[model samples]
Target chain A: MRPVEVGHRGGERAPRSTRLLGRHELPIACEADIVLVRRKARSLAQAYGFDAFATAAITTAASELARNCWVHGGGGAAVVEELYDGTRHGLAMEFRDTGPGIGDVEWALAGGHSTTRSLGLGLSGSRRLVDEFALETARGEGTTVRIVKWKRF
Target chain B: MSPIPILRIGTTLLCSVHVELDDALAERLQEDVLGTIERTGATGLVVDISGLETVDSYVARILADTGRMARLMGADTVLAGMRPEVAATLVRMGFPLEGVRAALDLDHGLALLAHGRSGATEGRRPGRTAP
Candidate 1:
């Protein structure tokens, strides 16, 4: 097992021996898509042997991000994948959108800040529910959010 | 998509949410519950979420807002049957579901409604009975 290093941005890099086991891409065009994405994440996490608590966290985080993609990002796609290291299994999800993008990511992640009529808990809350969280965005260029949840032994 | 079903029992409205609720459907539930309360004059609203696998911030807001609205329309709302994992995630998401009452199961929810009604007539209990 390779040592895990926590990046300065609070994101953790997958171990050097990590290998992709499977991948699924889902579209987030509307609210219904959020349910599909969330269910897919739930089943994947359960299949990966994540406990009930971890599975719930995974699905909830996926739901929040997917909702953000549909409501704030104006639509996007989610890529869910399973990764296996020499010693542990992990689930990685990436949400990407080409919408208006975020001008103030820091404020967005600060919590309780929303562009639309929402609770503004999407970015900050989703990050707190996962093991690894990273966000990439540019004004007028869209946004991408990546999260990884490692199975606990 | 079809809206969540609401059943009326006596003076209470029972809404069992079993499927995943999209934003539109969730909004529809709010309108439907309020409309039913107005028409039937339901004195209590009990929302059963036991079958829900997840309750994100958006859905949480809808539930809380629905409860608050029901109160304004002369009805007490009780959210019941939240899974433990779902409750943990909602806490992590920072939605404490303030201004709303919750019970452990459907039976408990109905009991709370009954207690509120009895307390309303007695005018002494501290439950959510109409003044």
Candidate 2:
């Protein structure tokens, strides 16, 4: 579903607690899909009242995670949503794929590591851009990565 | 899939990445760039990323690798027109961008490439002087 676009003018609905606002699902299959995810992320972040710089950060993080899903996990889907925690709002992105799972979580997140031919910064770099990051994977069950970038004051 | 365009200007080959880059497109870009340099005998290459609103570490690595690849092919690579926010994001993400020379604009990029070419020429011919 599309995010509810409330204007910057106050008195709409204050997100009193952490909650999911809207969600968009995109299949991560090809290069084009990567661009699509980034686009969705920018708009979602903006709709949630994130500034340009904050929107950029959210887009970058989303792009990295989505690309990782496609490149490493063969293919998957991304869920883009607006989130709020009290007065602080945020953008949340989650990617899930069914492919060979990461053999070493520590190595993957440590920095300068990649199972495929990459700079090995997809996971690590994404973590650096956002306020929260979590990854889950099993040998055959697939992989899931969730990241959140809170809007800055 | 259409590859990003790499334009040839004077002795400098300019590549402006206007679209979001993916792994396959980036690989094709590298190949196309190397091929163009070989065919045109260009001595300089400039990669402009100002059109990109955001870039991830993978794209950053590709740019850096392309710079190194161009250097290996006897051409100097100059990156130009990166947005400040994008640069900051890359830095925060810890993308070292090793061996990539950056300039603020296309004109400065061309100048940097020209200067590097002249330096290389001078080094190749120890006694040669600019006329």
Question: In order, what lDDT does every prediction score?
Answer: 0.85, 0.79
What DockQ was computed for model 1? 0.68
User: So what's the TM-score on candidate 2?
Assistant: 0.84
Provide chain B's TM-score, model 1: 0.87
* Regions of model 1 farther than 4 Å from truth: A1-12, B1-3, B120-131
Please give the lDDT score at residue B89 for candidate 2. Answer: 87
Tens-place lDDT per residue, model 1, B1-131, is 33688999998899999977777878898999999999999999999999988888888899999999999999999898999999998888777577778888898788778877766432222334465
Predicted structure with the largest DockQ when compared to the true one: 1
DockQ of 2: 0.58
Q: What's the lDDT of the predicted structure labeled candidate 1?
A: 0.85
Off by over 4 Å in 2: A1-16, B1-3, B120-131
Q: Would candidate 2 be rated incorrect, acceptable, medium or high by CAPRI criteria?
A: medium
After TM-score superposition, the amount by which residue A37's alpha carbon in candidate 2 deviates from its true location, in angstroms, is 1.3
